[model samples]
Target: MDAIDPVVGFFGLGLVAGMLRSDLKLSSGLYDTLTIYLLIAIGLKGGFELASRDVTALMLPTIVIVAASAVTPMVAYQVLLRLGRLPHPDAASISAHYGSVSVVTFAVGASYLGRQGLDYDGYMSVFLVFLEFPALTGR
Candidate 1:
C-alpha cells in the first residue's frame, strides 16, 4: 500500500512511451536514453566502489554474490514467462532489473545514511552479487 506510487508511475510512463509502436518513436528514444543513463550510472558507481574496496576481505563473498545476481534473472524470467504467461523477452528484461535492488539506489541511500551518522556493515556493500542466489537458487 505504501509502495504504489512508483508502481503507478512506471505504468503511466510505460503507456506514454508505448504510444508509438512503429519501430521507432520520439518517446521510445527518450525511454532508451533514460534507461541507458540508469545502466551507465549504476555500472560506473559500482566500478568506483569495487575500485575503492579492500580486495582481500571482499574476494570470496563478492564472487558468490555477483554470481547470484547474474543467475537470478534467468530463473525469474523463466518462471514469469512459463508460469505467469509473460512474453519471453519482456519478462526477461523486467526480471533482470527487478531481481536485484538497484545499485544506484543503494549508493544514494548509503550516502544519505552516512550523512545521518549511520555506519553500514561492510558485507552489505557486496550484497547484490549474492542476491540472485537466494531468489533463484533457494526454495
Candidate 2:
C-alpha cells in the first residue's frame, strides 16, 4: 500500500472522467461544503493536539515561521517585478498567492510523511493559520 496510491488513483479518475467527457462535475454548493469540512477537520485535529503542548516552547519556532511568511512575499514581489518585468499590481498579486500556504498541499505532504513513518511538529497547523494572514494583509 504505497502512500501516493490514493492520490494517484484520484488524479487518474479525474483525468479519465474529463477525457471521457463524463458529466461528473461537482456542484458549487457541494464543493464549498467539502472544502469547509476539510478545513474544519484539519483545524480541529491540529488544535486538539496543540492544546496539550507548552506555548512557551513553541514561541521561537512560531517567530521564525512568521518571519519566513513575511519575507517570502517580499522576495517574490521583487523577483516578479524585476526579473519577470511584471507590472506592480500583477507582481504583488502573484506574490500574495505564493506567500499563502495551501492547506491541501500541506495535507498531502503530511500524508506522505506519515506513510514514510516520519513526524513533524504538531504546531505546524498553527503556523499555517499564521502564514495566511500576513500575506494578504501585508499587500
Candidate 3:
C-alpha cells in the first residue's frame, strides 16, 4: 500500500496484535478499577489544592469556566463540519469529547495554577465529570 489509511490501519494492526498477544492483557475488571482509582486520585489532589486557596475570589471565574466549557463544543462542531468535512453527529460527538478536558490535564493544570499563586474554583472538577459522562451514555 502506497498510503496507509490511518483509521483502518490502526484497527487492522490492533486486531493482528491482539491475535498475536500472549499474556499482556489487562482484564476489563482491572481496567475499570484502575480508571476509578485514577479519577479519585485526581479529585483528591484537586480538592486539596482548592481547599488551600481563598474561596471568595473564584466565584465568577467558576461560572465562566462552566459556560465556556459547555459552549465551546458547539463552536468546535461547526468548525469541524465546515472546514474538516466531518459529518454532523460525528463532529458534534468528537467535539464534545475534546472540549471537555480530561482529569489528567486538569490535574496538571491545577498544580501549575497553584504553583503560580492562582486560585480556581473547585466545582470545575464536578463539571468535568458531567461533561464526559453524558456524552458517553448518550451514544
Candidate 4:
C-alpha cells in the first residue's frame, strides 16, 4: 500500500531473479510491443488532459523544460571532458545519454506521486517529448 511498494517490489523481483539465475526473459517482440503500448497510453492520456487546458497556460513551463533540456547536455559534456578527462567523442556520447529523459523513471515518479495523492501538471508528457529532441541534437 506504500507509495513506492510497486517500484520496490519490481526491482526486488528483478534482483532476486537475476541472482537466482532464473531463465526469465521477455521476447524481443514482446518487449517492443510493451514499449509501444506504454508510449501510446501515456501520450493519449496526456493528450486528453492537455486538450482540456489552454495552450498559453503551458507555454512558460514548456519553455523552461526545453531550455533545461538544451542546457543539460552542454553542462554534462563539459564536465565529462574536463573533470572525467574523457575524449571528445566519448564525452559527447555520454552527455547525450545523460541528457535524455528516461521514460521508465518518469512513469515511476508519476505513479509514486499519484499514490501519494499529489498533483502534477498533466502537460508533463508533452514536456517529455520536447525534452528529448534538444538533448539528442544538442551534441
Candidate 5:
C-alpha cells in the first residue's frame, strides 16, 4: 500500500489537472531528453550487471527472448487482422505498437518489485532493450 501511494497520488493529480484545464505541460524537448536519459540509465545498469556475469550463462535466454520478440509482431498482426477484423494497414500499425516494449511499464514494475523486497535480475533490463529493435523491425 505504501509503495503505490505516490503512483496513485500522481495519477489523481494528473486527473485533477486535466479536469481543471491546467496549462502545465511538458515540452517536446524535455520529453525527449527525459526519455533518452531513462534509456541510458537502464542500459548502463544492465551493462554493469552483465559485466559481472558469465556471458554463456545468459546466451540461451537472450537468444530465446530475441526470437520471441521478432515473432510477436507477426502474431499480433494476424490476430488483429483475422480476429479483430481490422483492415491490413490499421492492423499492422496497431500490432507494431503492441509488439514494442513499454519502458515506463518496465520501470514501474521494477520499482514496485524492489519496494516489495522481491529479487529480480537487473540483467532483465538488457532483455527489455533488446526487445525493442526486433519488435520494431520484425527481424
Candidate 6:
C-alpha cells in the first residue's frame, strides 16, 4: 500500500546501515528526546480529535480495544513458542513487538484514506491510543 512507503524506506535504510556495519547510532538522550516528542505529538493529535466527540459512543469500542490489546500478545507468544520453537524470552519479546499497535502506520493510513477521499471516524485515533499499552504489558 502507498501508506507503507515510509516504513519500507526506513527499514531499508536500517538494513543497509547494518549490512555496511555503519557507525551511526542514536545517543540515549537523543533517543529519549525523540520518543517524548513523538509521543506527545500523537497524544495531542488524538486528544484534539477526541475532545468534542461523545464519550458514550467511545465506551464500547474502548472496552473492546483494551481487551484485544491484552489478549493479542499472549496468543502471539504461544504461537512463537510452540510453532516457531523460539526460546521463551525470545518468543515473548518478539510477541510483544508484534502485538503492539503502530501509531505511525495508523497516521499514514489515515492520511492515505484522506487523500483518496474516503471517510473514517476520528475516534479511530483514540482506538490506536487505546491499543498501545496492554499489548506491551500483556495485561
Task: After the best TM-score superposition of candidate 5, give how far the Cα of residue 73 lies from its true spot, in angstroms.
Answer: 0.9
Report the Cα lDDT for candidate 4.
0.83
Q: Write the per-residue lDDT of candidate 5 for residues 1-119, one digit (tens) a residue.
A: 35455544455676799999998778999979978987898899899998999989999999988887878888999999999999999999998887788887787677777778999
Candidate numbers, best lDDT first, in rank order: 5, 4, 2, 6, 3, 1
After superposing candidate 2 on the true structure, give the runs of residues whose Cα lies further than 4 Å from its correct spot: 1-25, 136-139
- Cα miss at 68, model 4 (Å)? 1.1
**lDDT to native, each model:** 0.64, 0.81, 0.68, 0.83, 0.83, 0.78
Q: How many backbone clashes does candidate 1 have?
A: 3
Query: Model 1: residues >4 Å from true position, as ranges?
Result: 1-54, 121-139
Per-residue lDDT of model 2, residues 1-139, tens digit only? 5445564456568779999999888899998997898688778877977898998998998888888999998999999999999999999999888888888777767666777789887667778888876955762
lDDT head-to-head 1 vs 6, winner: 6
Model 3 lDDT on a 0 to 1 scale: 0.68
C-alpha lDDT of residue 130 in model 5: 78
- Of the candidates numbered 2 and 3, which has the greater lDDT value? 2
Clashes of each: 3, 0, 0, 0, 0, 0
Considering summed lDDT, which 10 consecutive residues are worst modelled in model 2? 1-10
lDDT of 1 by residue, 40-125 (tens): 66556556777777878777877777776767777888888999998877897788776767544665565566566797663465
Cα RMSDs, all models: 8.7, 3.4, 10.4, 3.2, 3.4, 4.4
In candidate 3, the residue pairs with backbone N, CA or C atoms under 3 Å apart (3 or more residues apart, or in different chains) clash, namely none
Poorest 10 consecutive residues by lDDT, candidate 1: 1-10
Residue 106 in candidate 4 has what lDDT?
Answer: 76
Residue-level lDDT of model 3, residues 32-106, one tens digit each, is: 896687689767755776787776776676667656766778788888999989999889888887676666556
Who is ahead in TM-score, 1 or 5?
5
> Over all chains combined, what TM-score does candidate 3 have?
0.56
Indicate the TM-score of model 5.
0.80
lDDT of 6 by residue, 1-139 (tens): 5555554555568679999999878899997996687668767877887897888888988998888887888899999999999999999999888678776567667766777789987667778878886744544
